[model samples]
Target chain A: MKLSKYNLGVIILILIASQAILAFLLFLGQPYFQLQGNSFFALLLLFFILELAALLIYEKINTARIKTSFGRFIKQIKLGNYESEESHIIQKYDFVNITDIQIELSELVGRIQADYNEQKRYIENVSHELMTPIAIIRGKLELLIQSEKITKSDFKLISQIMTKLDRLTRVNQSLVLLSKIDYNHYQDKATISFNDILDETLNLFEDQIRIDELVIRKDIKEDLRFNMNENLAYILIKNMIKNAVIHNIEKGYLRIKKLEDANGIQIINSGAVIHASTDQLFKRFQVEGGYQDSIGLGLSIISKICEVSGIKLTYTHHEGVHTVTIQF
Target chain B: MKILIVEDDLEILRTVLKYFDSFGYVLEKAKNYQDGLAKVNEFVYDCVILDLNLPDGDGIDLLAKIKQKNKSTGVIILSANSSIETKVAGLEIGADDYLTKPFHLSELNARVKSVVRRNKYEGDNAVRFNEIIIDTASQEVTVHSKKIKLTKKEYELLLYLVINKNRVLTKQSISEHIWGDFIDRTDSYDFIYSHLKNLRKKIMEKDGLDYIQTIYGIGYKFAEREIE
Candidate 1:
C-alpha cells in the first residue's frame, strides 16, 4: 500500500511516541537510568535507525511509482487521448487513492469533447443552411438582370445589391473556413515548397501587380520548404500576396526574400502610411485604410493557419512600408 | 439537352428550374431520394445534378447507382459542403464535376453544358457564336476562320461568354468563373474589363464583328448587335 506524505508523517510520529512509552516503562521497571555504555539503549538506537531507513526506502519507491503514473496521465491528456478507458486509470492507480480524481478528470474531458463536437456541428449546419438562401437571392438577381424592361437606374440598384451579396458570400465562406481551422479540419501535413507556392500566388495576382505598376523582387538564393498542410500553405501565401498587392500604392515595390538567420520567408511591400495598431490589424473585422472591398478576414486567416501549423507570424508597418514574416 | 436536378430544397430547385427553363432543355427535378432513383431507372438524362445532402438517402450512393445504370451519363454533384475531402470523394465516385453551394446559375449552366458535351460519344467539340469559334478539344479560338492568339485568361473569358451567349453575365459570376473565388476584390472586375478588352481587340483584328455588348451598370453580353 502507498502512503501519502501526511499519513506517513503521522505513522512515524506514532511509532516514535510508542517507542518513548516503552522506554519509559523500562525506566519505571529499573532503579536508575544510564546512557553511557548501555547495551540495551544501544540496541534500541540500532533498531530505531533500521526502522527509519526502511521507512525512507519504502516512501522513495512509492513516490517514484506515483510520479511515473501521474506523468503518464498528464501526457495522455496533453496528447488529447481523452477517450482512453477510465477503468484502466482507476485500476492502475487504485492503491494511490488517485482513482477518484482520475474519474472526475475523465468525466470532465468527456463533457468537453461533447460540447466541442456540438459546437462544430452547429457551425457546419449554420453555414450549410445559409448557403441555399444566398444561392436563391443570387439566382433571382441574375434573372432580374436578364429582363429587357429594366432601366439603367434599376440596373444600377441591382449592381449595388449584387456587390453587397458578393460580400456576404465572401464573409460567410471565410467564417466557415475559420471555424474549420478552429476544429482542426486541416491536420494533414506534408513537405511544401514555399518558393513554388509563392511564385504561383504571384502569377495569380499578376494582373493586379501590373495594374498597380508594382515592381517585384525575389531575393531567395534557395527554395524554402516547410512541412504543413498544402491547402493551408496555398491559402496563407495567397492571402499574404493579395494583401500586399491590394494595399500597395501606385508604382510601389514588393520584395520577397528568405530570412537569413531563420527558416522562413519575409514579405515587404510599399503602401500608404497606416495609423492602426499592428495588433488591431491581425484581428477579425479590423479594416485599415477604409478599403471598401476588404472583408478584413485575410490577416486573421493567415494567423489562424500559422497558429495551427505551429509557425510564427509577425507583422510590422513603418513609414509606409509593411513587412510580414513567417517563421517555421 | 436533357438534365435532372435532385435536391431536397424546394426553393433552390424551383429557382434552378426557372433559370434553366429559358435554355429549352427537358429539365426534371426530384425532391427526395426515391423519386430521384426511380427517375434514373426510368429515363436516360444527358446529365444529372445530384445534391449530396438528400433528405432520404446519401448522394454518393445515388451517384454510384447512376453510374451503374449508364456509364455514359454525366453526373455533377451540387453540395453545400465545400471541403476538399468531399470534393475529392465525389470526383472519385464517377462524378463529372462538383460545384459548391451559393454558386452562380451562369456557372452552373456552363458546367451542365460542358459536362453534357463531354459525355457525348461523338459530340461536336467546337463552341461557336457567330463568326467566332472555339475548338474545345485544343483550347483554340478562331474568328472568321483566322486563328487568334490569346492568353490563358482571355481564352477562358471568351469561352465563358460564348457558352452563355446572349445572356447578361454578371461581373461577380464572371470573376468567380475565371478566378474560382480566391481573388476577392471588386477590383477584379477591372481585371475582367482588361481581359475582355484584349479579347475584343484580337477578335476585331481578325475582322470579326463586335458581338460583345456592355450592359451599363450590370455586366457584359455576347450577342448580335440590335439595329438601334
Candidate 2:
C-alpha cells in the first residue's frame, strides 16, 4: 500500500481543509439555530459528527489507493498505456515517453538501472585492478618461498594464501563479466548452433548431476541452428536447468526437452512446484535461500535476452511441477 | 621496468608495495599527483600506475602530463571514481586501463603484466608461466607434454584467465565472456565451480602444477611467482 508523495500530500491537505471549514461554519452558524446554551452544545456536537463523516469519506478514497512505483508518474504523463499487474514490472515502465508522467517514470527507472550499473562497474574495476598486483605479489612471494626454502608447513600456508588470492581473482572475473552484461553494450552477432549449445549447457551441469545423484532426461533434437549468440542460449538453458535443479525435491525428476510450439523452439524444464508471484518469476534473485552460490543474475540475464531478442520466456507451476519455457 | 605508483592511502600503498616487492622491478611511489608529476619529469618510466583520487590533486591531470611528456610510456590510471565520463576522459587523455579502488591486488598485478607485456613485448603469441603453455598463434593450450581436453567454454575461460592471468578475473567478467548478453538470472555460479574443478583436475592429472588459486569471497587467480 504505497502512495506517491504527491497523492499523500493532497489527501492530507484535503482532510485538513475540510475540518477547518466545517469547524468555522459550525462556530458561525450555531447561533442561527438559537436553541439557547444547552441546545447550542448539541448543535456543536452535530457539526463535529458532520466534519468527521466528511473526513472519513476523503480518507477512504485516498487510503484505498495503493499505486505502483510508476503509478502517479504514469498518470501524470498519461501515455495511455494500460497493463495488468500480473504481467510485468516492465509493463508499467516500458515507454520512450510522450507524456510527462511517462517521461518521469522512465527517467526514474533509468536512474535506478544506472545506479546499479555504476555500482556493479565500480566493484568490477576495483576487483580487477586489485587482481594483477595480488597475482604478482603471490607469484613473487611463491618464488621467494621456493628460493628461501621455507618450512613445509609454512609453504603449505603460503599455498593457502595463494588459494585465497585465486578466489578473489575468480570473484573479480565474475563481477567484471556481470557488470558488462548489465551495461549491454556488446551486441556482436554470431551464428549459434543450438544443438552444440545444448551440449555445452549439459557440460556445465554434468558435474552437478554427478554430485546430486540426479537424473537428466535429455530429449533434444540434433543440429538445431539459430541466428543468435550461442553463449546467451547456453545461459538461458543453464539458468532454466539451475532453477529446476535448485528448486526441486531431493533427487527429484529433472526433464530437459526441446519442442516446437506456436511460440517457437521451446526449452522446457520440469521440477517441483514453485510458490511465488508469477510476475517476478523470471526476475533476478527471485528464489530465496534456494541457493547462495548464485549472485542473482541468472534469470535476469535470461529475461534481458528475451527482451532484447524478442523471444518469449515464461514460467509456470501446476500439478506439483514447475516449468520454465523459452520460445526461440 | 621502471614504474610510478600514484596512490593516496598508505594501507593500499603499503599492501601493493609489499606485494610488488617480489617483482624486483624498479618501483617509484608517489602519495599525490604533484609528487607524481615531479617523478614523471625526473625519471623515464616504462609504465605508470596512476590512482584517480590523490591527496593533493586528481590523477587525471597527471595522466595528461605523463602522456604529453612521453606517449610511449604506458599509463594505467587507478580511481575510486568509475563514472562513464571519467572512464571516457581517462582513455581519451591516453590513460590505458582505468581501475577502481577496493580491488584485489592480484588483478592489479595481472593488468600491470599485460600493459607491460603489450608495451614491452611486440606481438608475443606465447604466454609461459610454468608447465602450462598458452600459444596465441596455434590456439593450442598444453601442459608439459600431454594434450588436455577442454570444452569451448572452458578453453575460452582459460584463455581469458591466462591473458588476464595475473589479475583477478571477476565471476561477472567470466560469465559475460563465456555467455555474453545471453545470461539467465536463474543460472547458478556453481556450474562455474564445477568447470574450474575439472580444469584443475585435468591439469593435475598431467603432472603439471596447479596455477589456479582461489581468493576467498572473490574469484580465482593464477598465483604469481615469489622471488625471495
Candidate 3:
C-alpha cells in the first residue's frame, strides 16, 4: 500500500484538524461537565476515539484509490504509451495534488515529442540542402577534368579529389537514409516474400560472385513472408549479401539458411576472421584492416533498421567463418 | 541528338552545354521553372535533362507538363534529391530514366543515349562503332562480327566506352561508372585496370585492332586510333 505525497498530506491534515476540534470541544465542555468528573473523562476519550477512526478511514480509502488509479498511469508511462486524451482524473476519487503533477507530466511529454520532431526536421533539411552543393562541386570537377588544358599529373590529382568527394557524398546520403528510416518515412508497408527479395538481390551480385568465383549454397524456405517496406527489405538483404560476398575469401563458400522456427535468417561466409569485437562491428566507421573499401556505415545502417523494427540481430565469428543472423 | 538542359546552377548548365556541343548535340537551355516550362511547351527535344529543384516551380510538375505536352520526348531526371519516393514518382509519371546528382558525366551520357535509343530507335537495339557492335538487349558484343565472351563488368566497360567513343573519360569517372559509388576513396582505383586489361585482351584476340588507348597519365580512351 504505497501512499502518494498527496494522500499522505491529506491524512496528516485530517489528524491535525481532528485534534484541534477535539481540543476545542473539551475546552467548551470543561465548565459544564466539571461537576461530573468521570463522565467528562469518558466524553474526552470518546471524542479522541472517533477522531482516530476518521483518520484511519481516510488513510485507508485514499491510499487504495490512488494506488489503483495512478499505479496504472505510471505503468503506461513506463511502457511509453503516452495517452494525451486521458484527463488524469480518477472518477470520484481525484486528489488535487496528484492532478497537478499529472498535468505537468503530460506537458513534459508533449515537449519531448515536439523536440523530437524538430530534430528530425532539422536533420532531414540539412541532408537535403547539402546535396545541391555537393552535386555542383562534383560537376565542376568533372568539367575541369574534361578540359584539354589540364596536364597528366593534374588530372591524376583531380581524380583523387573526385574519389574523396564521392565517398563524402555516399556518407551524406547514408546519413540521410538513416534519419529517414528513423523517422518512419517509409511507413507504407506490405506483405513481402524475403525469398523473392533475396533472389533478386543475389542477381544484383551475380557479377561480383562470378568474378570472385564464390560457391553459394542456399536452404531458404519458400514463401517466408513478412510485413515491411519492400525497398528497405531489399536493401537489408542486399547489404547482408554484399557483406558476405565482399568479405569472403576467393573461391569461398557462401551459405544462407532459414531458421527452423521461421523466426530469422542466417548468413555464413568463409572469410578471414574479423579482428574487431562484435559490438564494434556494428558501430559506424569501424571497418576492419583488410576491408578498406567498405563505407563502414553498412552494418550501422543495418543495425539501426533492425533496432527500429524490433528485430533481433546478432553477429559471431568462429574459425574463419563470419556469421550474421537477423530474427524478425 | 537535340537535348534540353534545365538546371539552375550556372556552372553545371554551361559545362553540360559545352560538353554536349562537342558531341554534336544541338542543345537548348532553361535556367528556372518558367523558362523551362515555356521551352517544354514550345519545342520538342530528343531528350530533356531536368533538375527536380528549380527556382520558380517544382521540377516534378514540369516533368508532368512535359509528359502531357509530348509523350514521345525522352525525359531523364537529373536531381540532387536522392529519395526513392521522388525517383519512383518521376518514373511513374513518364520519365524514361533517372540519374542522381554527383554522377559521372560519362554515365549520364550513356544513360541519355540509351534513353534516346529506346525512345527513338525502338527496333534497332545494337550500338555500333566501326568494327565493334554492341547488342544492348542481349548484352552481346562482337568485333568484326566475331562473338567474344566478356565478363559482366567487361561488357559494361566496353559498352560504356563505345557509347562515348570519342570523349575522354577520366579514370575516376570510369571507376564510378562501373562500380556505382561503392568504391572507396582510400583504396586505389587501380582495380579498374585489371578489368580494362581483360576487356582489351579479348577485343585484341578477336581482331588485331587495339581500340582502347591509354591517354598517357590520365585514363584509357576508346577511339579509332591509327594502327601502328
Candidate 4:
C-alpha cells in the first residue's frame, strides 16, 4: 500500500511521456500548431523541469526524516538504552517499507537483548552457586588440617591443593565481578577521592612493593574526586597497580601521574616491554610469559569497569616503560 | 565460650561443629530459620555464626530475631554472597563481622574469638596469654610488662596465631588471614615467614616466652612449650 519516491518519480515520467506523444499526434493534425510549436515545446520542457524539482524537494524531506529517526535509534542502542527501542521507532509515516525494516530490526534487537540478559544471569547464578561449595570444601580442608587428621607429609600436599582451590575462588570472584560490572549491577554512587582509592589499593601490595624494591613516584593532587561505585573503583585501581607490579622487573620503578586537567590518571611502570600484541593484552586468560601466578582476568575486568563507569583507558609502551592512562 | 551456629549446609555444619569441638566451645546448631529463631529466643550465647541462606526463611530475618532477643550476643554473618549491600545490611542489622565463604577455618576461628572477646569484655580491650598481653585498644603487644613494637602486619599475625592457639595453622591459612584476598595464592609465602621471624625476634628480644612453634614444613603454632 506504500509507494516510494522513486516509484512516484517513475510514474510521473511515464505520464509526461504519454502526454507528450498525444500532444505531438494532435499537433500533427493541425498546421497552425507547427508555426508556434517551438514556444509550446519550450513551455512543456519547463513543466517537466518543475515536476523534477518538486520530486527532488519531496525526496529530500523524506530522507531527512528517516535519517533523524534512525540516527536516534542507533544512538540509543549505543548508549545501552534498549528499553526505548520500540516506542521511539513506532511512529507511522509515509514509510511503509521502512516500517517493515524497523519491525524486523526491533524483533532482532529484542531477541539479542533477551539472549544477552539470560547469559548474564547464568554467569551470575553459576558464580554464586560455585562459591558456597568452594567455601565448604575449603572449610573442610582447613578443619582436617587443623584436627591433625592427616600426616605431616600429606599436610604439604593438602596445602598445595588448597592453593589451587584458592586460585579457583579468585577466578570465580573475578568473573562474578565482571558480570556485575557488565550489567551495571552496582547502583550506589557517590563522589569519592581517587587519591584515597589509589592509596588504599597500593596498601594491599605493600609487602610485594617493599620486597621488589620498586621505586614509586606519585604526582597525585590531593583529594581528586570522581563519582563512581566505590567497590568497582577500588578494583579498577588495584588491578592497574597490581598489573604494574606483577609484570615489572626487579627494582623497577612505578610512576603515577594525575593529569593537569584533573580528568585522568596515568600509571607508568618499568618492565620488559610487553611482547604480546596490543589486542591480546586486555584479554582474559592471556597471561604473560613466566607470570604463572596471574590468571589474566585483571585487565579484562579493568576494561569492563572502565566501560561501565564511562572512563576511557588506553595502554601504551615506550622505552621499556608500560603506561596505562585512565581518563575519567 | 558458648557459641551457636545456624547453618543449613550439612557439610559446613558438620565441619564447623567438629572443628569447634577441639576448641572446647559449648556449641549449639540449627538448620533453618524457625529453628534458629527459636534457639536464639531460648538461649543466651557468647556469639552466633549466622549463614545468610536458610531453608524456609531468610537469615536476615533470623538476625533481626536474635538482635531483638539479645542485643549483646555477637553475630558473624557467614555468606557465600560477598556483595557490599548484603554486608552493609547485615552490619546495620547488628552483625558483628562478615566472612565470605570458602574462608580458612583459622580465619573463622580468629573472627569468632575476636567477636566473643569484644562482647564479653564490652570494650575491655586486653587479651592476655600468660606472660604476653595484647591491648586491642592500643594495638600494642607487651611481654612481661615490657613494651614491644610490632609492625601492623606483625601485630595482625600475632593476634591471629594467639587467638587460634595450640592449633596448627597452615601457611596458606596464615597468609590468607594476614594479607586477606589480596594475596596471590600461586606465589610463595616467604613474606609471611619474614613477618613471623620479625614477630618472634621482637617477642624474644623483650625476654618474653616464645610460644610460636614451626610444625616442620606444615605451619606455625602458638602454644605453651610442653615441658619435655
Candidate 5:
C-alpha cells in the first residue's frame, strides 16, 4: 500500500473529526462517572491512531487497484484491441468517471477502422478495374500500329499516346505497391546479402552506366548482410541504384561503400543540384529536375520500405554530390 | 499451335483474340471459370493463357487440372495482382509463366511462343527469319551460315523482334522486354536506337540484308522490304 499526498490529507481530516467526536464523548460522560481525564484521553488517542493507520492502508490499496485497471485499459487501446470481446476497457473500466471516456474512445476507434477498411477496398478495386481497360487499349493500339493504313502523322500520335499510357500504367502499379506496403502485405522476412543484391542491381543498369560513361566504385571490406523481406530489399536497393544512375550527369561518378562507423551502407553520386527541399523529394509525384521519365515515386517507395523495416534512412545533398545512407 | 484464353473480361478477351488472330493459331476462349474448366477437360491445348480472377473458381486449381490432363501443355497465369507472393505461388504450382495485367500483347505473344517452344518434345530450337537463324538453346545467331557475335541486350532485342516480326514494335515494349518494367526511363529509346544501329552494322558486316525498318516517329519493324 502506498500513500500519496492527497490520501495523506484525507487521513489527517478523518483523524481530526474522530478526535473531536471522542473529546465530546468524554466531556458528555464527565457527569456520569468520576474518571481520570489523562488516562481516558490517552486511551482515546491510542484508538484514534489505530483507526487512522487502517484508513491509510485501505486508501492506498484502493488507489493502486484503480491505477492498474487504468493502465490495462491504456495498453489495450494502444494495441488496437478495441473490438476484443473481453476488453479491459469494457470489463474493468466501468468506474463512474472513466466509463464515459472509454465509451467515446471505443466509438472513435470503430469509426476510424471502418473508414480505413473502406478506403483500402476502394483503392484495390480501382486499381484492379483500371487494369483491364488499360490492357485492352494497349492491345488495340498495338494492333492499330501494325495496320498499313496508319500514316506517318497517325503513327506519331499513337507513339505519344503509347508513352502516356505507359506512364499511367507505371503510376497505377506504384500506387498499388505503396498501398500494399502500407497494409503490411510483405511480412515475410529473410537474411539478405547486400553485396549480392548490389552486384545484381548494378549489372541490371550496366548498359545505362556505360552509355553515360559513369565511373563506378565500390569500397567494402566484407559482405554486408541484413534481415528483411527479400523482395522489398531487392526493390529498395534497385531503386537506390537506379536513381543514382538516372539522375546522374554525363561522366559523373557513383560510389557505393559500407559505412565506416555504422552497420549500414551509403551510396554517393554526382548529380545536378536540386533546389527543392529534401523533405519534398520523398513525397509522391515530387519530381525534381523535371526529368520526363521520372514518375517520382522512387524516393517514396524507398522511404516506405525503410519505415516498415525499422531501418534508419537519411538523404543529404551537398552542392552537386548526393548521398543516401541506410542504417540497419 | 493451339491456345486457350480464360478471362472474365469480355473486352480484354476480344482484344487478345483479335491480336492473336494474325498468328494463325487455333485460338479458343472461355469467359468464366466453368467454361474454362469444361474446355480444359475436353481439349489438350499447347498453351493456356489463364486469368487468375475467374468469376466462379480459382485459376490456380484450373492450372493444376490443365497440367494434370497433359504435362506438356504450358500454362501462363495472367493476373492484375503484381505481388511477388502471387507470382511465386503460381509458379510453384507448375505454371509455365506469369504476366501481370495491362501487359504488352507483343510481350505476351513472345512469351507464348517461347513457352510452346520450350515444351516441345522434339526440341526444334532454331528461330529462322530469312538468312538470320537464332539457336534459342545455345543463344547463338547465324546469318547466311556465318556466325555473328551479339551482346546480351542486342540478342534479346533481335529475338523479340524476330518473334513478333513485321509488327511495329514500340520503344516502350522493347525496353520493357529487355530491361524489364523496373528501369523506367525516357532515354531508353536512345539505348534502343544505339543498340539497333550496332545490330544493323553487325548484320551488314556479314553481307546480310538489313531487315529492321524504322517506322518514323513510332518504332521499328523487322520485315522484308516491299519494292517501291
Candidate 6:
C-alpha cells in the first residue's frame, strides 16, 4: 500500500483553480461586491469550478485505495488463482505506480521463463533417457518379431530390453526427485553432525560395497557437526559415495575423509581421477567414460544443497583423487 | 517383489506396469506423492520404481523420506527428467539406479534385475547377453564364446550399447557416457565414430552380425539390421 503526493503540477493547478473560484464566487454572490450583471455569470461559473475541484480530489483518494489492494491480488495468484481474469482497471490515471506493476509483472514473466527453461531441460532428458530403452525395446522386439527363428541367442536382447526399461524406471524417479529439490523441498534447516550423517548414509551403501569387493575407510573427525537441513546432507553424502564407488577402478578403494573446521567438511574419495573438468561432474546428463547407468547427477544435487543452505561447495581433482569440499 | 508405482499419467503407468507384468513382476500403484509415500512407508519392497514428477510433492523429497525409513531397500528412480541433477539425487539418496521416462519397459527390467542380483543373488557370476558374456565378477566380456579384446573405452561402449541395444541413443549421450561430462571442451565426435567403427569391425571379424545402426540426424541404434 503506497501513496505519494508527489505531483506538484496537479496539486498546484487544483490550488489555483480553488483560489480563483472562491474569489469569483465572493464577487458574484455579494450585491455590494458585484457592480455588473455580465460578471455575475462568470462568478457563478468560477464557484462551480471550485466545487468540481473538491470532487476530483476525493476521486483521487478513492482510486489510491483501490490500487493498495494489489497485494491481495498477488496473494491470490500464489494461492493458485493464476488463471483468474485480470481485474479491469478503470480511471486511467497516468503515471500511477506503473513501475510497481511492471516490476511484479516482470517477476511473473521471469518465473514463467524459469519454468520454461526447466521444462525444456526435463523434456530433453526424459526424451533422451526414455528414448534409449524404448529404442532398444522397439528395435530389438521389431527384429525378433520379424525373424523366422527366435534364436536362443535373441532371448538375451529381450532381457536386455528389460534391463533398460528398469533403468528407465529408475531414471524417472531420479527426475521426479530432482524437480522436488528444484522447488526447495525438505528445506527445514537444522543442526546436523557432518560425521553422523555421513556414517548413517554410508551404512546404506555398506552392504553393496562389501558385495562389490570394495573397502570402506573412514577418517572423519568425530563430533564434527554443523547446522544444515539433514535431508539434503544425507543426499549429498550418499551421492558422493555412490559416485566414488561406481566410478572407481575394479577392486579400487572407497574412502571418506572429512576435514572439519569453522569453514566446513571436505568429503574426499580415492578413485579413478575424474578426467572430465570438475564442473561437468555437477551437470545433468554429463556422464563419463560411456557409463550408461550414470545419469550424471552426482555433484549437481550437492550443488543444490549448497544453494538452499548458505553452504559453499567446490570440487577439485588433485593427484588422481576427486575432492568435494563443503564449507559452511 | 511387488513394486508400487507413483505416477500421474495413467497411460504411462499402465504401459509400464503391463511391461513389468509381462516379466512376471507384481506391481501396485498410486497416482501422486502422498499415496506413493504411504505405500513406500507401509510396505517392504525388494526394489522401488519411483518417478520424478508427482502432483502432491517433489520426487526428491520422497527419496529422502524413503531412505530415512529403510536404508537397505533398493530404489530405482524413474523420471522424465534425465537431468544430471536428478541422477545425482537418486545416487545421493543411495538409490540403486536411475532411468528416464518414455523408456522401454525392458531397460527398467535390466536395472531391476541388476539391483536384485546384486542385492539378492550376490553369488551369481554371469551378466549374460546373447553369445556375449559379461563376467560381472571379473569385468570380462565374451562374444559368441570367443573373447573379443577391447580397450577400456571400447569395452564401456559395448556394454552400454548392449544394455540399451536397439535404442536410438544419441551421440551426445554416447559422449557423456564414455568421455565423462566435460564434453563441452571437445571439438569432434569423430572419435565416437571411430570407436563405433572399430567396435563393429571387431564384432564382424568374430562372425557376429553388425548390430549398431546409425539414426540419420540423431544417433546410433545397436540392433542387427536386415542384410538383404
Chain A vs. true chain A, TM-score per candidate? 0.75, 0.48, 0.71, 0.68, 0.71, 0.58
- DockQ for the candidates, in order: 0.61, 0.08, 0.29, 0.41, 0.57, 0.07
Task: Report how closely model 5 matches the true complex, as a DockQ value.
Answer: 0.57
User: Model 5 captures what fraction of native contacts?
Assistant: 0.77
Model number with the top TM-score: 1
lDDT tens digits by residue: candidate 6, B133-226: 7675666777787888887778777777776665555554565566543232122255678788888898778777778876543356676687
Clashing pairs in 1: none
lDDT of each: 0.88, 0.62, 0.78, 0.81, 0.88, 0.64
Candidate 5, superposed: residue stretches over 4 Å from native = A1-113
Which lDDT value does model 2 have at B36? Answer: 89
Q: lDDT (0-100) at residue B198 of candidate 4?
A: 92
lDDT (C-alpha) at residue B121 in model 6: 46
Candidate 2, residue A17: CA error in Å? 44
Which segments of candidate 4 are over 4 A away from where they belong? A1-78, A81-117, A147-150, A260-262, B121-124, B185-188
Candidates' TM-scores? 0.86, 0.47, 0.76, 0.80, 0.83, 0.43
Using DockQ as the yardstick, the better of models 2 and 5 is 5
The digit string of per-residue lDDT tens for model 4 on A1-328 reads 2456666777588658866885676577557555476866776677667767776676667777777777766675676643333433334223435657877776666676677667866886787689878978887776666664677788778877876887898888888888777766776788868898888778888888888899988898666778988888888898899989888888999999888775889999998865787669888888865787788898899899888888999988876789899998
Task: Supply the DockQ value of model 6.
Answer: 0.07
Taking candidate 4, what TM-score does its chain B reach relative to the real chain B?
0.92
Superior candidate under TM-score, 1 versus 6 = 1
- Sort by TM-score, best first: what order? 1, 5, 4, 3, 2, 6
Candidate 5 has a TM-score of: 0.83
Cα lDDT for residue A17, candidate 1: 82
lDDT of model 2 at position B215 = 50
Model 3 Cα shift for residue A254 (angstroms): 2.3
Task: State the RMSD for candidate 2.
Answer: 15.0
- Please state the CAPRI-style docking class of candidate 6: incorrect
